[model samples]
Target: MTTLRIGNASGFFGDRFSAFAEMVEAGVDVITGDYLAELTMLILARQKAKDPERGYASTFLSQLTEQLHTIAGSQARVVVNAGGMNPAGLAEAIRTAAHEAGLEIPVAHIDGDDLTDRANTLGLGTPLAANAYLGGFGITEALRAGARIVVTGRVTDAALVTGPAAWFHNWAREDYDQLAAAMAAGHVIECGMQATGGNFSFFTEIPDLRRPGFPIAEIEADGSCVITKPAGTSGAVTAETVVSQLLYEVSGARYAGPDATVRLDTITVTDLGDDRVRLDGVRGEAPPPELKVSITEIGGFRQEITAYLTGLDAEAKADLVQAQFAHALELSGLPRPHNMEWTLARTDRADANVQEEASARLSLVARDRDPKTVGRQFANLLVEFALGTVPGFFVAAPPGEASVYGRFRPGKVSQSEPIHRTHHDDETSLTIPAPTEFRGLEPTSLDAHSPAPANGRTSAPAGSQTPAPAHRSGTTDVTLPLGRLFGGRSGDKGGTANIGLWARTEAAWQWLRSELTHDALRRLLPEFADAALDRVELPNLRAVNFVVHGALGEGVAYGARFDPQAKGVAEWLRSRSITVDADIAGSVNLDDFFTAEHTPASASSGSDAAAGES
Candidate 1:
């Protein structure tokens, strides 16, 4: 079977600077770069407001300029969502750059995803930036039109891979299964080193993680692909690493996209040794009738102040600061903030060796519609009480003026609403139509027990003993951290966060399914006591994913929590102690798994570490 090698260079706007040159040198058929995220759109919007010609990722332009001659000399093609809020502008810029570099690379751009002008009419409220999620066919059309480089705005990240695969295979519009399989491959490599070993929960198991290489998908005509990295790369690509990326930021079995809905439950992962993992048996369904729109708006102004309380009377010191701050606000004669939240983290220890170890953190976050409420006046008020209240009352840093915060919300419109179009170098526009056949997405059902009932009760109100699982009746239980036998991956989806936990063996999976119930999770993580929760089981992957709604309030841009994106929430859950069967725990050999190592052939001895952020 003929295979198209698709490699990812840049995952986000600030990814490794040299990845594009590296991937091109690796001789891949295509290079895809994903630079836009939910928060990125908002940041670009602010940039565009300041300067009209600057909403796109500028780093891509520089990379292309530096490597234009090499790319023009190779058979490799470039596809990137770095166009961000302005595909047409970015395409024109690329053409200008190519001309200046003495290269004639054909650049094409896909647009019509921007919905800011028609937002209110389409029931999407007034937002700073609004872009609909487009399918991959526009990219396919551009590629078929003989464009060597394709620029897109706000398409599904997977479209970079699916579009190229469809174009290469001449797939029809209704080739749902093939498109879904390609989408799975795209999702794996969309974050570059993530599909490799960059953020694997079992990081200790992989060797030479420093400066891991980006991932590539050897996609075949039938939609099956081997997820692997370039030979002599630093990172390891195994079944476990691929599974970790598959579960990251996903909710249920039905992973819906603009082109097709993927049945994540049907997918099977096979390790083919030497850093190659085969993904097959994927099933897909018809595309949804409506397209998802990401809308970001300026919610309000926010300011924060953190005070370090050391030694004794930590509680009293926190109380004194809160009371003083409230009284100061009242006396300032300024309007009160719309919302105020205070958190006291007791990180101090008794008889600590260092002063830093004996201090707790008391933070105050204030938000308001009017900037003056949380602006310089608020900071000055907090500083006024530095000498009057609490012993050793000092802030971590000087509070700055309030800054604008953004809120993200999902909107939907008819798939045909946006005039999807491809602009070629010859000044011709090709319109791409929406899918003729559509289906409403339905919740995926599983044979296992249903998720905990939605009673809005965080924990069994104060006295009722939560019943234990029936499977644990006759087994000897030992208290241990969940990370001892399981691995987890987590990320934020708008305002919600998802944590996917998987076991290494079948027996461990059986124990996990029975022990980690909805109530059990709430009991373990009391911080999510009031948030709405939903749990789904994927028996094929031996994993259970939990979705916590409202965990990040409005979104990552809103700065609702300390760890706003919830990237480390899974690690926090893994640290929580839980009771497990001794047999299941003793059967696993974590030491052996961590000790086994295979050194990379051409590993670079550099200090630059790659982060796995989506």
Candidate 2:
């Protein structure tokens, strides 16, 4: 089969709108967009509650509506998870939009991924939405039936690319290696500009990031592919950027999808030069018997208040603010919430400087089953501190109204259940078959309580502890920030967060693996000392990924922590000074070499740093 060029436009629901048009103009064979994340499902469910026709990603349809002719003319097959909780409704909306535009694109919608009924049995609160992460088989079937555009609800992100690749290569269920390769390619480009330089640790090196081009994967029949962007796009694709993204939010050596189990240990990345990173040697195993099901349900109400502390004694002032607030709450005779978090973030820079630079923040968050407890009463109690608190005291912003939040619960369902169905534009639909054999694929990082492998390399699941690996020995040593020797990337998966740390060289990797043991990690971030923790080593990528189970306390939307999604987890770790060999610590040349070795993919690009994580 010829090489398949797949381009990804939108990473999340509200991604760059111009990406689709850019992919279309770039002449991609297939265009895809990943519009769903764990929290996004809950958001969509809330939207569906307001209006049944409003559940799907409006941006997906808007992109298609604006670029339907361009996409149809370029002979590009469009696939997106924009269907959210309503794949049928999204498909119908697209069909209607296409008709109004005087176009007749054959659109297909994949169904049966919704597991609301099955989830109800667990009694896991009032479910907002229950979705099973589906595979690419239905998409392949839809494409076989001549679907110009395919809409899916909750398929794995990589399935967007693997589906087309499977259809193009006629890959069977047993073609594990090839399928694994395609899945790797999909994973690389799935997050749009992430394959470029969006959230790279060494962001100073990449140039022309003003508007980075969306990522494209050029995959061959063998499964090896070059990850790149449009020729004139802003961001650059290099080994470091690709590796950074590869480690983002991943658990261990294995990355499981509904279609296959990809072994990250064997994955290899090579700089093919000229804005391309060749990905190869991705191996695969049979997928697990049960598919992952995301269950989002109404948790309760939450409210937060922040007080600013500046200049001398900022930490002391923050303490006073918290004390006064608690006293006020007590004097008001108001019932306390179920849970409360008081955090004093010392962002104050050292030495004499502007007050803005010396300012610290004291934040208080409350969660409860009753709205009144976390609502106006909570806000009023915080304001009472303004008069009696320390000097230079002020609220960062108004204590806004309390908001409803959703709790994320990860579960599994037998593959045989949740029948897969695909509806074609020609008024035809069919049930896609489930694999007969139970592959018994080990559960994903979702099962934080699972025992770790006996190898002692990965963390002891979440609650368990493992013996610490030996620390590296060196005669001459110096103290420097961890970022001096390692680069890191981190993000959330439901209530869990994974931080991926990598070294530039083999020697560095060895030192990192030895020095960054489970015990070392706990020492560095004592805040999560008791939180469930697991570490996975990826020697092939010179990286180690640490999964913090239940770190976010119910997930981003529901979590009251300041860094809810753990976006700053890696950055925070990097800022901590660590002892290292004097030679390694002083090797500014090594850092300089890396800066120049990997060129940016496109013109200087500007991106919303926070939103780029997903």
- Candidate 1 — what's its lDDT? 0.85
Model 1 clashing residue pairs (backbone): none
Model 2 local distance difference test score: 0.80
lDDT tens per residue, model 1, 147-190? 99999999999999999999999998899889999999999999
lDDT of each: 0.85, 0.80
lDDT of 1 at 213: 90
Per-residue alpha-carbon lDDT of candidate 2 for residues 402-449, written as tens digits (9 for 90 to 100): 888888878888887788999987789989888665455453331224
Model 2 misplacement above 4 A: 122-125, 441-475, 586-614
| Candidate 1 residue-wise lDDT at 40 | 96
